[model samples]
Target: MAGGTVLVVGGGLAGITAALGLADAGRSVTLVEARPRLGGLTHSFRRSSRAGDLWVDNGQHVFLRCCTSYRRLLDRLGVSDLVSLQPRMDIPVRSGASPRVARLRRSALPAPLHLAGALAAYRWLPPAARVSAARAALALGSVDPDDPAVDEESFGRWLARRGQGPRAVEALWDLVGVATLNAPAERASLALAATVFQLGLLESNDAGDIGWVRVPLQRLHGDAAARALAAAGVRVELRTRVGRLPTTYDDVVVATGPAVSEDLLPGDALDLAPGWSARLGSSPIVNVHVVLDSAVLDEPFVAAVDSPLQWVFDRTAGSGLDPATGQYLALSLSAAEELLGRSVAELREWTLPELGRLLPRSRSARVLDFFVTREPQATFRAAPGSRKWRPATATRLPGLHLAGAWTDTGWPATMEGAVRSGEAAVASVLGRRTERTALGATA
Candidate 1:
């Protein structure tokens, strides 16, 4: 299979990683993307306002130190310098119920103990609830996310059985779960939730340390990837849609969204019932971007509790806005089912006062501009029994593979999952090639 032609039918992180890995392995790779730009769901666009033209990302995407694959992809893209990782895992969590801000900063202790200090002192939960939460976290460490029984149960139900009340869920579990899983604890699977908590928080001390892009996502991913792919001698076809799988390539990687993949793949390719993609479903994310007359939020980002606002990020630096000008903030609202259909005016009306409540300075600051970005089908719905819908990398059809966050990457639908899926797809493809070569040699 040396010098074999490989066709990757998506320009996302998954497809890009697969293309690069294949090309580097001596395959003639061609990446086809229907979008004009390469960075699939994670992209940026220009917005005009009185302040100036700003580059706004579709959503505020962040990564953790545990996300080795995504970070490696960033290094490969040569844009590692364009992002910033925290020296320690520190999250400024603010609650609307109280004026005081709580911090989820990890200490220099060992696994589980590293966060004990922060959890013990958390003001959001009662003293007993905090202890219960800690105990539940320890219990979660023992829960194998790969088990089929775990996938059948909901995280909320599991937490409830362990004495986690609604307060603990809202103040603690859902704080991280909703953002990562894109579904609240009641609806999210225990398996996916366990994976996020164990790998991100429990397994290692520094694994949960946060990192975010310093520049626009397009520049960090799409543009950098385009340059990297070109340098690697991989052919890229932007704005090219494949209605049906091309038979010419030695192997094909369908790395698009589940719906798109379903459309392109042969009916018999996957071992699933009809309408699996539809059954897998999707969740929505609504990003409310606001420009103020003056700076309100001091930190780079802050998580919210007891309010509709989820996470607020200071986008002044990344949006290309002048410091002298007002401030730009983007509020990332995950599991935003109700807010998806709300009008911009309605969002502005509701969100302004909420921001004022969270950040008191926002009440006095005049709004320069306010807008919204919605991703209805953001990620595959990580509900209970979702694993059954997510197929493995290899399909029943030979030389055809699947690569996406929706694939069976043993992780949630994050940048890490997408990159891991791509790597897995590459391994599957090359592994099959080696098997065939060995068989031929034996014959």
Candidate 2:
């Protein structure tokens, strides 16, 4: 525990979290990052605004009330005041020719009773559907995440058996799936969807309430994390990728990508040997940003009820813009496997019309150019039966810990997972002893 220096080889939120956690715990550490800046996927840059220079996130990210760990990170970084938490469970879902909005609220009745009150008065649902949706929610909440059968059935199948038909599923249950997993009901795993619900809704009355960033992703996450780490006396190095570990010593953290992890260890030990580690897969995300003449959206973030666009975020005030001619909107397409290879032009062809259709005022709005960004492997594919593949924070290699959203953090591959993985990696590193990694055909 004395006179030991650790090297963490990444600068994403997880890496930053690990470094800071270790440093705060009285450990000396150096962080190496491959990119010029930190923040990994959540980044921002200068964009033109009527009020002058502006910053906006690549895409908006939101959290549920139950995400206590994430909130604690914000508080530690002193940015808690920069965000807003929806005080009540309010979901505004809209679809089709005429937009219909339904807001889900809670009552003092408690647990299933609160859910029943919200569902009984849910106007968008038919009388029969309201009852069916309630039953389905109850059924989903009652299902145990530990049960093997939960992962065997598709969420769509489970919903259907619980009385949710196609339209009702799209309007109600699908919102739950896509809002959480970034996939529609049919595409997502029943176990994952149920976990999202059980953890978010049934477990607590206001836990499903949303919280989103009031500023750009990079400023809110990367810059804040880097600054906090530096203040804590952590050495933060960016653009210095580590291809191999300093084998001269036995204590270090490998927080890089799949290739780097495999490159560092003996006999291709980190290569996962086509087993647990090798089984890691990824999903794609597509983000589109557009500027209009006026504020097209008021909410900080919104999940598209029954559309291919999973979520949308409004960046007006945060971008230093006048509401009239300086409103920016970002659309995030999660699990965007189909749209991964499409050109931005082809994407805009369909997306622009959809946006206009959703926000009628945008029909007459002037186009201030558009931009789209795609990440083919933004996160690990969290499909059914895939849970067994996600590894823990510690590996067989001593002093070599893993930190990423893919690790088993009892959460979907998310920002929270990334932060949690980093914290776990640090804990594992701090507990390391005089032992070293074996140099044999490791796995």
Candidate 3:
């Protein structure tokens, strides 16, 4: 397994990460992708506008400073400077329930203590509820993410048992949880909730600092990854779908989605359990892109509460839109079931008023263009008992491994998880030897 040919299927972040790692380790690797470009989830498309042609991302994706693996991938791809991290952890939140806009920014302090100032002044919840939220955070920090019992129950019920009211869930937990876990507290697993909170918030003050790509997603992920992979001397095959196992390679890594993985995994060779594929479900994400005559948001991004808007990002600069003409805003709605089937016109009609309500500047701004992008199966639904469905990187069949966000990486389905899954797969493949992975240590 040291220097033989390795076939890595799927050109997404996971495949790119794996291919780069294996090639850098002096292994001959062939990377194949069904799509014309790389960066499976994080991609962009061209949209014609009166101002000029612009590149709009499939969705507005962001990562936290805690996502070390993904940041490492960026650094490896030589595109780390293309993204921007917040100077400090700050989130401007606008709630339809209240007229006042609340800011969730950290102070100069240690872990957990850094958030005290922001949460104390958080106007979304009552003073009593804020205190309750603090207590809940402390309780959540104690819940070990690795505990199996924690996955059997929903996070919403746990919050209720701890005296968390509806206001606390919407204003505090779901505000962060929905974006991170891709489900409401009632629907998400307690294990993932605890993991997101403890690792991103409680572990360190800087962990929750948000980072986003300044350029188009295609530039940051697809194009940059291709450049890095080529420079690494890995043979890349695009627009080539791998339906069957190739005999040219000694080892193979399936880095596709769960549904795709089921089709690609040879049942006769791999002793997969019955209905193993059905165990992992899917979730949807809806993104609304709007081109306005003028700027509405001063900050680059903001989270919304008591409204349909989950997170809104000002992508004018990212989209390369002409500032002299107007601005471009992308509204990201995770776990978007209701909006998935709706037409773009219908979505535009509904979201424009909401934008107007949240940003007074948008009321007078003329809508130049509006569009929507939907990922029906954006990621596997991280429901209660989902952990049992997720398989390990090492498969029952030798020389065959699974690498995707759906794989067991402790974290949920994210860019960080995807990259970690690749690293884990490489670690499993090279575990027989004493080779170190690109992630630094073994496995």
Best by TM-score: 1
Q: Select the stronger candidate by lDDT from 1 and 3.
A: 1
Q: How many residue pairs clash in each candidate?
A: 0, 0, 0
The weakest ten consecutive residues by lDDT in model 1 span 434-443
* Local distance difference test values of all predictions, in order: 0.93, 0.73, 0.87
Q: Estimate each model's TM-score.
A: 0.97, 0.90, 0.96
Per residue, candidate 2 scores C-alpha lDDT tens digits across 1-443 of: 54467778778778878877877877777888889998887788787544456676665678888887678788878788888888777766555346666667777666767678778877767889898787777778888776767765677877778778887876777666665676677766687788888988887887877888777778788888888988988888888866556644345666655444555555433434644545656677888888787666776666565466656778776666667665778888887888888887898898988887677677887767577877787776667766666656777666667887776676776777778888788778778774554444422
TM-score (C-alpha, index-matched) for candidate 1: 0.97
Candidate 1 achieves a global lDDT of 0.93
Top model number, lDDT = 1
Per-residue error at 24 for model 1, in Å? 0.8
Least accurate 10 contiguous residues by lDDT in model 2: 434-443
Q: What TM value does model 3 have?
A: 0.96
User: Model 1: per-residue lDDT, tens digit, 1-443?
Assistant: 46788889999999999999998888889999999999889999999998899999999999999999999999999999999999999999998767799999999999999999999999999999999999999999999999999999999999999999999999999999999999999999999999999999999999999999889999999999999999999999998988877677778899999988887777778899879999999999999999998999999999999888989999999999997899999999999999999999999999999999899899999999999999999999999999999999998877888999999998999999999999998998888763211101100
lDDT for 327 in candidate 1 is 97
Q: For model 3, where is the 10-residue window of minimal lDDT?
A: 434-443
Models ranked on TM-score? 1, 3, 2
Better of 1 and 2 by lDDT: 1
RMSD of 1: 3.5
Model 2: what TM-score?
Answer: 0.90
